[model samples]
Target: MEDQTPTRKNNSYCKRKIVTVLTATLTDVAQQTRAAAQDLAGLSTDLKNQALESIAQALEAATPKILEANAKDCQRAQESGLATALYARLKLDATKLAGAIAGVRSVASLTDPVGSIQLHRELDTGLELKRVSCPLGVLGVIFEARPDAVMQISALAIKSGNGVLLKGGQEAIHSCQALVEAIQTGLAASTVAPEAVALLTSREETLELLNLDQYVNLIIPRGSNSFVRFVQENTRIPVLGHAEGICHLYIDQQANIAQSVDVAVDSKIQYPAACNALETLLVHKDIASDYLPKAVKALQNQGVELRGDAAVRDVIEMDSATDTDWATEYSDLVLSIKVVDGLEDAIAHINTYGSGHTDAIMTTDDQAAATFCSRVDAAGVFHNCSTRFADGFRYGFGAEVGISTQRMPPRGPVGLEGLVTYKYLLQGQGHIVATYAGEDAQSFTHRDL
Candidate 1:
């Protein structure tokens, strides 16, 4: 028993053990997920309802643990000299924890979209065509320090009958780990495969997960512009998210002056650090002399730094903003102001420099509002409301995985409905395709849904 093994041999044995463990984990996860997918596809409405109820219960019960883990993340972030805005994002108190739980319950309440037939048609005598909603298999989500996003995405993925692999920021590792534990426990209780919901434990593991394209179907990155860009360029998987939110608020010449001022102030100062918060303010030149100074003064009173163009500076004494200012997404208590010639200039400026995220136009004229709403290349175009309303929750979507600005199917807040995709099913009884290949083939009628 006292015989000593060589150090090199012992090291090799340890490495082998780790490799064996990782291999076994992945294998088991794959098997469980495959089983889960099959079961989900065959799930009755009753079983799905029961699973959702169990998930809601689990989220509610895990509140205390969630709060404790969030406290640790907040303390660490504060000690590590993280930016105040970032720290706020990482911190989650009781209210946010409750809201997260509510979000899970909200997903449970939404109608199950899986198996819902979107379209149906007949190709030939014995062939029938149908298009039904189905899960996207496995979704890999890489996100920053927002612990609640984990719960929201997990609920949506499960409700949509898809597997999820989450890679959260290291800053909120403890919180994310705790949340994952709760989710797994819920899955076990509901007889759902726990492996269907996996969380990466380390940054290196995240990189490895990103490369697991064979296992992952879609990649959704929700974080800073740099992080999103890095994921997009590094991975071949299709990404479903946006890089930035350079939202703008424009005040037209025909705008109600009082409403314009209120909307501008509220949009910029209500929650300056959020993506939907206004970063730039464009005012019509005809009314700039009367409105620019007033708006600047109101923002300054709220501690917002007003950086303006030459015309704006002439109206109000503020920092001279450069061309770069128009393109910046200063997620802070700062704003860029530019005075435009008219509606055309305003539209041109937003389309050229905006992030295609969210923009608003304040105008009293019906045609002006219609033109602004139709022309702006943004996910959301508001008429009189503040840009801050560009949120899934605010738009009545229960919860959102992220706000997408891509010119694709999901161009706005991605909620439970966004997690599902469509598949076409063709049922034929001894119908040969060769019969339809001739020049005098029977014409197929295409009916609209």
Candidate 2:
């Protein structure tokens, strides 16, 4: 009890001082990564691929260390009463680590997007114009739970000729550190600077990182709806990610019951922790009597807890769903079911409550499938398939930065193509823009080159 007032003040002062130091260190790292990104953007495809291969090998070599670190994280998360869904995402076993390593190797085999000419033309004689793809500089990625995201994002960043600063959830700190250390160690053996890829361990760094608009070109946040929205609202940097993933699957009257049941079961239970997993199941009223009982049995057998509307409840026994249930992104084993009058009603329900991430229609009717594909305003619209198919790797992109739901170019699972921007290049023999000026300007040729 002696001098307790002064001790509290001293503790507050220490906290502020530590935060200040961390902020300063983060700024220095951003500057260094910006500089390193410039060097990376100029490297040839072969060189970049070599670097990725090295990283993959390094990750493979460090598998034991990575697994041990992940075990510690899992233990801590378990002891702290972390959500089961999040714990699933946080766990990185040998199989998952091997898959991540394989993904890195796959990224190395992709066609490098840098320097590809999108447009080539001649404005006039000896004046050639070309629009070429280039790197988008440094990316600041903030993700939760998924430590495997560290490896995927780093490989994608390096392959796309961009630098990245990764901020993983505190739950996966040890795993992230182990992964990034191996990545940097691999980069040390390659031409790419290890600084091009870094990990920021503290939550304080995430807030400070958003303020680094000067160095970070984009901020990709992958987490809960509220967390993603917070990142979007706080950052001046352009955000590229979806806030929620309230994906839906509609069963039409013309749907093959066996196929629809399989798709629905797979979508909900295959990997419930994934963002693309089905959350809301809409059934055509005409098919509800025929399909609901079987689908409910299949889903329940797999441990899916369903909350259904009145119409769905009449067919099968389950909990009642509220209006809020329609809009929820239950990245877990929970699902909500509704029975719609027809295709129009199904589409309306989806458009109203869906997160615009991924939605699918299970039907053999070609016309209905085509209509659903065109009318649904989602990043991914599938016919007779599971929403989980809406993935970057499954789309043959090797890996993804994250899924973007904004009504913009980089919507859906963002791959290397989404990471690059284009620049215009004009070549001339001492030519000036004044030559194309008004009045006596020479008639110019706009021929394709």
Candidate 3:
């Protein structure tokens, strides 16, 4: 019994050890990532691409190891009764792995955002001013079940000249470790510092990381609404990702029947677990009787459980959609349907109930489509296209940090450009501001050269 106590204590110590180590490691890595950012900032585009290429290759070589870890996570999630949507998100088989690897290579092929000069102007004889792009150092990314996120985010961090601290959900711990191992191996062959990219394992470590505003420059959280809101409230660091993905698709009266059905089915069924997948669908009253039954039947055949508003309930046989249903982000094989008076009413319902994430309208009527696209206050407003098109890779941004529903400049897909900010550089031969201040001061030339 006495001997067994020490063994039990040792096991307990191992379990709790990483939490303390993670705190210290995060503090240490923050500085290291900043230093790595400086080193990465000056490196050539080709070198960065080379690093990404190495990471992709290393990942491809380590597929079996990664899959084995993922399997363990999946098994545990099943036993723990994880939700169906998250379970789907957590699973990473060969196809998703290949896509993640391919995404890395795609990032490698993107135009380098760092060191790009946005503006160059000669102020006056030899006095020059330039605004150039630079990395946001030490990003802390906290995401949910998708282990593929680890690969995409790390690759983006490397390509964008940013150091990232990744915190994935507890369910995907083993998979995250396996992915990080391959990533670090690739980083070893690159110019980035050894500690530039890191992952924190324990749940306690994440709370500590939120307080690291001094070290972590930006925090991007991708998870449930509560999870994202908690991160935002706890962290002084800037949060840049959207939590609610209550996207909407409206079919105008003039919509092509085949086109509308195809986009609707694909949006909800092709990959319903995606953040940009359709959630609420609004059809014009003029077209509801004609379109609703067909839409409901097709969706039902795909195993989608439909919930509809009162008007929709009259048109299709389905569950009654409550107030809660309208506000929900299913992220599953489920959708809420409604019938609207017209394009404007559809737009109003979307703006009121939607998350400002992604909204689309399917209409052959050019005027109605134009009105809906312009009036709807969402990050992405598409015409005659599926809401699922609102993605970084699909939008040709390579691997993104995430979709930002922020109303600011980085309002949509957060690609490499979103990872960088601008710095104003002034070049002068001892030119003082006094010369440009008062009477008899030199007139400034703001001409672009």
Error of 1 at 166 (Å): 0.6
The residue-by-residue lDDT of candidate 2 on 209-271, one tens digit each, is 888999999999887777777778887999997778899999999999999999999999999
Model 3: residue 278 alpha-carbon error in angstroms = 1.0
Residue 114 of model 2, lDDT score:
95
Higher-TM-score candidate of 1 and 2: 2
Candidate 3's C-alpha runs over 4 A off are 1-24
Tell me the lDDT of candidate 1.
0.79
Each model's TM-score, in the order given?
A: 0.89, 0.94, 0.94
* Model 2: ten consecutive residues of lowest lDDT: 1-10
**Best of the two (2, 3) by TM-score:** 2
Task: Return the TM-score for candidate 2, rounded to 2 decimals.
Answer: 0.94
| TM-score preference between candidates 1 and 3, better one | 3
- RMSD for each of the candidates: 6.5, 5.1, 5.2
Instruction: Extract clashing residue pairs from model 2.
Output: none
Off by over 4 Å in 2: 1-24
Location of the lowest summed lDDT over 10 successive residues in candidate 3: 1-10
Q: On residues 132-194, what C-alpha lDDT tens digit does candidate 3 reach at each position? A: 999888889888888998988988888888888888888888999888888877777776665
